[model samples]
Target chain A: MELICPAGTPAAYREAVEAGADAVYCGFRNDTNARNFPGLNFTTEEMGTAIAHGRARGVQTFVALNTFMRAGEEEVWYRAADDAVALGADALILADMALMDYVATTYPDQRLHVSVQASAANADAVNFLVDTFAAKRLVLPRVLTVAEIAALARQVDCELEVFAFGGLCVMAEGRCSLSSYITGQSPNMNGVCSPASHVRYREEGHDMVSELGGFTINRFGADEPAGYPTLCKGRFLIAEEDAYAFEDPVSLDVMDHLEALRAAGVSALKIEGRQRGKAYVAEVVSRLRKALSAPPAERPAQLAQLRRLSEGQRTTSGAYEKKWR
Target chain B: MQLPRPLAASINCLPLPLVQRAVALVFRQVLARHPGLFDRLGPYANRRFRFDPTDLGFSFVVYPAGPDITVYRAGKAPPASATVSGPLVTLLALLEGQIDGDAVFFSRSLSVSGDMEAMLALRNGLDDCGFDLPRDLSGLAGPFAPPLQRLAEAIRARALAGMV
Candidate 1:
């Protein structure tokens, strides 16, 4: 199976390919990419150079034109798709139905992958995308259990991609409006979630309080660990007891279940942090690529080393184990 | 040394204006250290402020619309143009340059009502403030902060090791 890794910049793309990623995925610096973060993403010339670099190393490249098109702004998304195809992207990962239709009709021979943001959880949704847009693969949302993934894989004709490591999204993909509610910036619309512009932190006596948009999400004592303020993973008082109302502060580590995912017909495993530095990208991809080839029995110990690399030193199988009630 | 119940109650009921004063004092200390931030922020520092709590009679409002800082109670609507509602601790964080405005707005950790242009100006102004810890504190208290910073540095070190 292919190891699909995120590359937020040209340097990251080069790092991923050199570190043994089978394919590297990235977005243009504009709103078309889901990670429309400042100081991140690539320009058209940079993408072209990155694609050339990836091709020189026998690694494939995928461009994410994954944000939903705004009204009267479809042309921006269309030009991005055209540019990706011109730059020799191995595939185009799309979320908007209109953009998908445009690409499928305009460039029938180009490979297309349905982005997980489209929330194609079942065979019907996957089949619809495949049939309508000629999507060759579908990136499954993080809402499914391993059993559900296996069942859906059996039913769907398109190839499947699952997030194997890094950040976890607690919400059903493509259905969340939490970011837009406060920041007026939608992940689906603006290609950014919990953008850095709204975060504020202050030290009060012994506690370091973290606030997002003037609201306190979590306060850490000088001794406690503090994670970034993403609304879904924040802790809140529910019925007088403080608990993570949505999800805990943990990364997803599915390295232990790689074999099961492979057997379940997943064609590619994705690593999620494109906004991360190149060193982080290189290290994780290198480790995961090694672990995938190792015999199943010997993989756990190798995977354990990745713990020191994870956020807050905690990792979960996420929705893969049906732990969500 | 036990106090009467009435006295304890009185002590607990400090004026909301006093609380706002204390927050402003701490914010002033932070601002003092980053004078360049004020020059960069320009007109945003002059905007009015409205602070409200979810509970009644606990609003601490500050209006920077005048030459001197003005503190007022919430019921009269404090002559300010913009209103931000949250705990005092969160406000201090925003004033101290500790949090990113975009992350806060997206998470709904903070809500700003009225004066959209002023809010945007304030966010950009705050960014220029540069809320990094003083060098002395970082050097002395490096071990106590979150380990992610250390881990990131370590990864960078390891990646650069033997190469340069």
Candidate 2:
């Protein structure tokens, strides 16, 4: 399986290529993509050079135009899709059906990928996108069990990509309504979830309280491993007790299930960190590259190195194993 | 984690002005080499960034708009739009894009307070700079550059090793 890495900037793109990414995925410096953070992503000229740089080194480039277009602002997304195809993207990862329809009709030969934001979980959804948009791949959201993914892979004709490491979204891909309700920004609509612009950390006594949109998201002790104040990962009053109502704030690491994913017809393993720095991209890509190339007996030691990089130095198989009640 | 006691004491004992002057010189060199470095900071370019090295003896106040940096003893540093507190080694590693900011922040080795967006923009800008302290410094160093570079590299390695 190919190793797909995220590159938020041109420098990170080169780092990913050097660290052994089979394909480097990035987006423009606009709201057309899910990672539309300020000072991140590439400009049109930067994307051209980045693609050329990666292509010269045998690395493929993927442009993500995965955000939904706002009404009357469809031209912005359309121009981006046209630019992506003109820039020679190996594939265009998209979530908006209208944009996908535009791409399919405009450039019949352009390779299309259904972004996880589309939440195309079942065979009907995946096949529908594949058959309609002629999507070459489907990035499965982190909501499925490994068994479920394998079953879906057997039923769909397009290649399947699974996130192997990085932040876990409790919401189904870009459908983060909890964040939207609080911050008025969501991945699908604004390409930001609990945006840093809305985050505020205040020192309350000995604990540090993180708030998003003026609501307390999490309060941490002096030594507790703190996480971003995304609403879904927050502590809330439930059943008259303080509890993590949704899920724990931890990263997903399916590194241990590479062979299973491969045997299940997964075509690629993705590292999800477009908002992360080049250092994270380089380290994760290099470590995963080594683990993938190592002998099965030696892979554990190689994979173990990534544990320190996981959120709060902790990782989970997410929904892959379905270990809970 | 704090710096080793002896090293911290040594740094503390040094004249604050001399250290400040040296830091300013290094900052000038970095700016010269990476002119548009802070452009990615966008609107936050004018914001003050207080890099409070929890392990070191001083805090640095950087004005990205001015491309200027002012250093002061830890508690004496002026207020800024945002403060990023971390070990000196981790801070340097982050500036050079040699360490993962999110990983270190998650593990509690780094902390950010006030104006989260400003800090985020600064971090993104620095990540794009691709800085290598020794190399960038050595370029500005005279004929004794090789030995100076080696010494800086050794010190950096030792400090980062202690951090790990």
Give the alpha-carbon lDDT of every model: 0.73, 0.88
- What is the per-residue lDDT of model 1 for residues B13-97, given as tens digits with 9 covering 90 to 100? 7776685676566445555665544342245557675666433345555433432344445465655556776544445445433
Tell me the TM-score of each prediction against the true structure: 0.68, 0.96
lDDT of 2 by residue, B1-164 (tens): 45688988898888988998989999999888998899888899889999998878789999988878998988998889999988888899889887877787777787788888898888888898889899899966799899989998997777666332
Q: Estimate how well candidate 1 is docked, as a DockQ score.
A: 0.03
Candidate 2, residue A59: Cα displacement in angstroms equals 0.5
lDDT, candidate 2, at A140: 94
- Cα lDDT tens digits, model 1, A163-246, are 999878889778898877777887899988876566665557756676777788887665454555678877799999998898
The number of the candidate with the highest lDDT is 2
Candidate closest to the true structure, highest TM-score: 2
Among all windows of ten consecutive residues in candidate 2 chain A, which has the lowest summed lDDT? A305-314
In model 2, where do residues sit more than 4 Å from their true spots? B162-164
RMSD of 1: 11.8
- Which runs of model 1 end up more than 4 angstroms from their true locations? B1-164
Model 1 chain B: ten consecutive residues of lowest lDDT = B132-141
What DockQ values do the models have? 0.03, 0.68
